[model samples]
Target chain A: MSEFIKPTPMPRKYFTPTVIFLSVIALVGIIFVFARLIFGIGTVTNLSNQYPWGIWIGIDVAAGVALAAGGFTTAALGHIMHKEEYHLITRPALLTAMLGYTFVAMSVAIDLGRYYYIWHPLIMWNGTSVLFEVGICVMIYLTVLYIEFLPIVTERFIGRVNLPGLLKKYNNSVDKFLRALDRGLDKTMFIFIIAGVVLSCLHQSSLGTLMVIAGPKMHPLWQTPILPLLFLLSAISVGLPMVIFESVLTSRSFDLKPETPILAGLGRMIAPILFIYLSFKIGDMVIRQTFVYLTEFNTASVMFVIELVLGIIVPLRLFMSPQIQRSPLGLSIASFLVIFGVFLNRLNNFIVAYTPPYQFTPYFPSVGEIFVTAGFIAIEVLLFRAFVMIFPIVSVPQIPAVHKTKFSIRGAK
Target chain B: MANQSRRNFLKTSALIGAGLTGVSSKPAKAAPNNILDENRMGVLVDTTVCIGCRKCEWACKTAHNLSAQSIESYNDRSVFKNMRRPDDKTLTVVNEYAAKGDDQFPVDVKVQCMHCDKPACVSACIVGAFSKEKNGSVIWNGDRCIGCRYCMVACPFQVPAFEYGKAIQPEVRKCDFCFDRTKDGKLPACVEICPMEVLTYGRREELIDLAHQKISLYPDRYVNNVYGEHEVGGTSWLYLAGRDFHELQFPKLGTNPAPGVSEAIQHGIFAYFVPPIALYALFGGVMWLNKNRKQDEHKEANHE
Candidate 1:
């Protein structure tokens, strides 16, 4: 258990062609972001009063928040559900979530016309507004995510809290403080874990509620009173798949043997949750008779069918197969489908399904808008890699015990 | 390119479904506000009387201090070649629908903010940046606006246009029913400038009565429907048109208030704070269950 618990940072070269390429994209994106902030949203986005929200809200904030569900899902599974073996993936998930949310905050700033008043939702409470609820819940959940990550920061520095030169005297004191903080966090960490899961559920569904207010503006195919339920169900369903997807990708990137057995168990969890989600989706469509619109061959109908078939049904079938669940490629593919499905679903809800009354032209995101979104994703990938390289995210417990003995012998000498 | 195949697949899927027809019911209307302000102001636009002069467009810009061409230059019938909406640059636009057979003049409809009684924008604005004033105008405040633009999405009439051209300190521009002028015992800019007396400004209740009286008096001249009286829970601006309102680009909408469905669901789940508390308790129960199991596993390990 100690061997499994004591994670070590991965030893790898930081600068690769992929990293440099991603950095370039991220740099270009940052430039566009500055353009947006300085010249306003109109300059960077194709968004108008006719289509006030575009890909930034749909992809960046909505899809980003959903993809980051791995953190809370793993937290609940490992800490609150006593699935102790799942603990190995929790740290990486937490880091991903922390960075994902940080990106979300930055996206909100970039997306807002009045970026300076981003904090307005914090102080001016409109209890009736779904956006207000989403805002407050996300802010609190972000804080909770950081608090949940403090132990990881503590773990990295606790063992060797050494400082250079004159600050050496305070190193021991800092070490003592970290150790005390780590101990204190362990005792109360479950509270934050539970709070994190609850807060996530609130905002996940509240995001759906944000669209529900658009009412007539939202196409009938996507709009339903059960939208919040569907959003919550989809988020919960996609959680395990995101973890599996990230885990598989992480292993491949680092050239480690994927955690096939643990991930196989996680993969099994996806089908059942997805079944629940599909049932709600199909049932809601039937109940509302939204399926009638499916025959129209329009953009909304086409996208709706794609979201259902490619994103949900195909992934559901793949995940249900026991053999496919165990296979890394199959599991990864299935998980990617689910993630992609949720992303498409958000896009459908925010853009495709939304038809403002007076719009004469269909909205396509501007080049700046696409670049800014791509930049945020690139930034996420870069940060995740850097963090994993520096901190103890992925484990290296399989290292030979002979090195440990040699280290102790050297210390004695 | 891959998207084309996906669309084809969806088309096939759509065709595969048969005999599964079910009709969706209309969205349930939210409870109407019982305390109607009888003295609140409203405008009755008699579209049949409008001459398509576009003078209201000029007057709106001039009164709002927006750039406008000379008032006489507004007589350009060429501008009516395409339909236009009330946008940032133009507060009001007069659209020409070809008049019925043998009629000399085309149906000229003037479009602007409806200023709904139960304004969806007011309800949807997260920061309370919009409000339905006592004068029956749905007004926006730039100071409180965070530029989230949720209100623009929420407006059924889609009247609130943003100053999307501005880089800094952009505003949500809309018809405020001349809120300031109304407060000073003056008519709205467009209402005061109509040479044909196309706009009749008065109390909302009296306007409704007058609209009904006009519709009945000349049933041949009117469609017998007083628009904005019940559409989307009534708007400050009512319309009496000769042809069907839909022919003049009026959206076909239900009588229910626009914010009703969303608010019902949002407020329902969050009512009395029951669900959130219940969810927390459920998480707590799960945590407690896991704690016991963890303890049992620890005890078994200790025994070993």
Candidate 2:
């Protein structure tokens, strides 16, 4: 248990190459998006006033926010509820949340008309606006998330052993310092854990409630007063499944053991929460009778029905089956489906369902926009790999390296 | 030190519990609704008197120093070629709708900003860029606009247009109901420029009465309905489409105040102290449960 992590350090040569690669991708993305700004959406992308918001709005921000809810959800289920089973996976979930949120800032860079002027909202604050609330909460939550995930990075730094001669050349202070920092992380873990849960709850719901101010402009099929409630609930339902999917994929690709015990409990948890979310959403729609809008078979209503079926009913049913939950393939399929559902629900609200009778031209992301979005994902994956490689992301450590590396060395000899 | 503090915390737990109870049960007053102006100035457009000529639009542009959208000339045969709208550049436009009956030519339906009483655009604006003035106009000050285009998303009328091209000067452009004149007790340029006396600008109550009186006097010419009286939380601008408004692309917007739903529900649940207080207790309770359970686990491990 003490030797939870081993020092590998991916040969320092890969560091600069990786950094250079990332910087180049970011630079290209910046240049292309800047060209769009210089020329306009017409020059780069197919966005019009009709389709004012597009993939940049839906996928990058909304879905991204929902996905990042993992930070709070994992903390609440693992630490707060004292679910010892999920304790092993908590660090990775926190890491994902941090990366997901940082990407939100990246997503904002792609979406805003004047990325330079984002400071205006802060320099000249408006407390009344929902965006103001969202902006403030997300900003604060960013710090909270860093507080939550920083320990994982620090822990990895602390737990690393077998330091080579160069690292030890600076004397024993660096080693002692890292050990002290590791102890400090454990002591303050309780505070960061609480802060993570509270802040996440605030911003996850803020994202949904932010849209409530849209009034009639937001198509009736998706519009509701209790938007924050629906948004937060949907985020929680999606967060668990997201962790499940990531866990299984890593296991299969790396040829690790199945995380069945943890994954099964998670699969069972998702269906009920999803069922509740659907019940509330439908009940709210019916109680308010916004369902009346369904008679008019416009784009918004049709998409709403499709989202309800695909994102909710189908995935919910599949997740409930014990056989399905037990099988890795079935669990992966369900997990993927759950993510898709969350993605589609957000798309329906942000893009497909939003109508401005004044002038609506449906916006699809420009090629530059798509690359930027992809760039954010790539960075997230890169960060995950780096952190997991350095630290013990998986609570349950295994002997994969000793088995595989010894075989490779034998083959070489 | 930790043991002493823990003992102290436990001893005062009853007092803290009582204090928390008192702290809750109180209604929270969120920031005031700056968007709601006690008196918002508006124009009640009587659709019946509107003769299909877009003279008011021409006068509006000339007064505001604007450009032509589609109509290059007053009598340009394509005057109604495409249904023109008030967009980023143009503040006023008149759309023509033909009647189902024997009336010749088209009836002019002027389109401008509705300037709602409870303006969603104002609340949606994060920088206080938008303000519903006491004189009944929703004004936009671009000094603080971050240009997230959220105001574009929030407006019920979908009135605010983002100057997307002018990245440097990306402001929300909408009809302010000419607030520049209202502060001086002068009518807006469009209201003053109406040659046929079609648009009347006055207090909302008087305007409603005038619309009703006209409908009563000549029921045949009007639809006997004031369009904006209760539509979407009652806009300051009213309309009188002589025929059924649907014929003129006036959507079947209900009289219910839809914007209020979000504000009301959010305030109802959270504006009071019930949720946060309850949430804190729930979190504390869960934490307490975990602590006890952990102690039991330690005991079991030691015994084993």
Candidate 3:
């Protein structure tokens, strides 16, 4: 059982045309990032006082963080909730989260005007500010994520601590050190797993609390007292779908056998979570009497309708079917809808439904801003591919004789 | 060592529990000391008395040490053709709304920061970059500002303007109510320079009373309501407009304090650390329940 669960790096051609295309996009994004840093936020973004947050925030940071919920959800299920079958998906989810959060941090650094003073939130305590809570939690959770990844790092390097020339003598010490570190981490991992779940809850809800501060500035159709709960619930609902989406996509990309039964189990988990989210969403609107605004036939109303109908309702109905849950294509389609829905919900909260009073013009992301956002996602993909090639992230079901020879040649070199 | 560490953890947790209770018990005061002022200063702008002259705009720029076109250049009535807002370059702007039904002189409303009793910008700034001064001016600290512009989003009146043009040291520019001058026991730049004495600068409490008296004295001239007296839980700047304020582009907001709903929910869940601890405990219980099941799975798989 232990041997079967042990992950090994995937075997695939490293430099595919798709990888090259993504690299070009990432390179272009890097150029604009330099422009943003050297010039100003205004130079690269269409963000004004009227629209301080554009897609970089709406898509890259807010939506990025929400989509990364798979990390905690999978960890909680596999390690804490004792769902051992879900263990196979955990490492990949963690890798995605670590990379996703790193980029989220980088995006924030680019977005901030005083990017150098990004650490001020740590020292400056403003408990009342939701952003303060979010900043602190994200900072701490990122550290926890790195700590969680240490065992994986140890696993990769423990026995293969070879060094060239004069450094060869130090290999034995390095190997021993890694083994000790791995042993220590294995015993104490549960504490960090618990903290990760707690920290995730804090920030997910606080992101919603951030929009609540906008108050009358946000359209009534989206505003509610229970926004934090809705945000948390929605994050949880989208968690398993994101895991399934990544797993199915990876399976197709690497030409590995798809874990159909496990993915189908994940599909079942999505329904009840989505149902809870919808109930609260509808209940909040009904109680606040904000449902009337849905009839206004404005941008906010139309956006709300589309967000629920396409993002949640249709996906929820689809996921309930046994046939849809069992097929990789059906699971991917349903999960994509969930991802799109949550992304739209975040976009609605930050940009679509927000109207600054006495504004002359509406805001749209500039070419540079769009490029930078695309670049962040592209970099995440490139990094994910690079790391999986170097480390044992994705499980290799079978190691062919040819592959073993190739691995030994590479190791010897 | 283990016993001492356990005791330490328990002690710290108790202290945190006490502190959280303190925060939730007085949710209104969770806003910070800058929000509370017994005798904060204010301004009452009688728009009915204001002529279309733009001298106050020039004075504000000059007093703030911002570059201004000559005072005479501001007198060009053509500038009022388009309604303008207080931008990064300009701290105050006068917009002329044509009076309803046969009036020659346009209603000129001077616009700037309302400096709410509970300033949302102050509350929203994550790094504590903004604060409501004791003199009732919401001021920005450039060094502390990360330029998240959460303040700009949070402001109901949309007063905070960012320096989008500058590549370096861009600031959130807004009317500071001439806080520096007021600290020196002098009037605000615009209030001191008003030729018609249309701007009355005084304590917030006295100004509200004065606003009501003027509204009653000239019942035919001004609206009965003092625009900013109770809006967004009152503001330092009170307004007496001849027409509805919405006509002048002032956002129609409820009397609720801007941070009320956000703070309530944020404080409610975090209060006494009840929800977080309970959530942790719940997860721990789940871990416990599934512990045996996981071991059983491992054993069964090994047997296979």
* DockQ of every predicted complex: 0.31, 0.29, 0.50
Over A214-264, each residue of candidate 2 has an lDDT whose tens digit, in order, gives 655677677776788888889999899888888886675445676786788
Candidate 1 ranges beyond 4 A from true positions: A164-166, A400-413, B1-36
lDDT of 2 by residue, B3-63 (tens): 7457535534533454457652211112122445444556888766777567777767766
What proportion of the real contacts between chains A and B does each prediction keep? 0.63, 0.42, 0.69
For model 3 chain A, where is the 10-residue window of minimal lDDT? A404-413
Local lDDT at B142 for model 2: 65
Q: Chain A: TM-score in each candidate? A: 0.95, 0.84, 0.95
lDDT of 3 by residue, B63-142 (tens): 99999999899889998889898989999999888767775457899999999998888877887778787778888877
Q: How well does candidate 2 reproduce the true complex, by DockQ?
A: 0.29
DockQ-based CAPRI category assigned to the predicted complex of candidate 1: acceptable
User: Chain B alone, TM-score of each model?
Assistant: 0.86, 0.81, 0.87
Off by over 4 Å in 2: A1-30, A37-45, A120-128, A158-185, A252-255, A281-302, A359-368, A390-413, B1-40, B52-55, B62-79, B272-274
Which ten-residue region of model 2 chain B has the weakest summed lDDT?
B24-33
In model 1 chain A, which range of ten residues has the least summed lDDT? A404-413
- Arrange candidates by TM-score, descending: 3, 1, 2
Colliding pairs, model 3: none
Give every collision pair in model 2.
A50-A360, A50-A361, A51-A361, A51-A362, B40-B136, B41-B135, B41-B136
Tell me which of candidates 1 and 2 scores higher on DockQ. 1
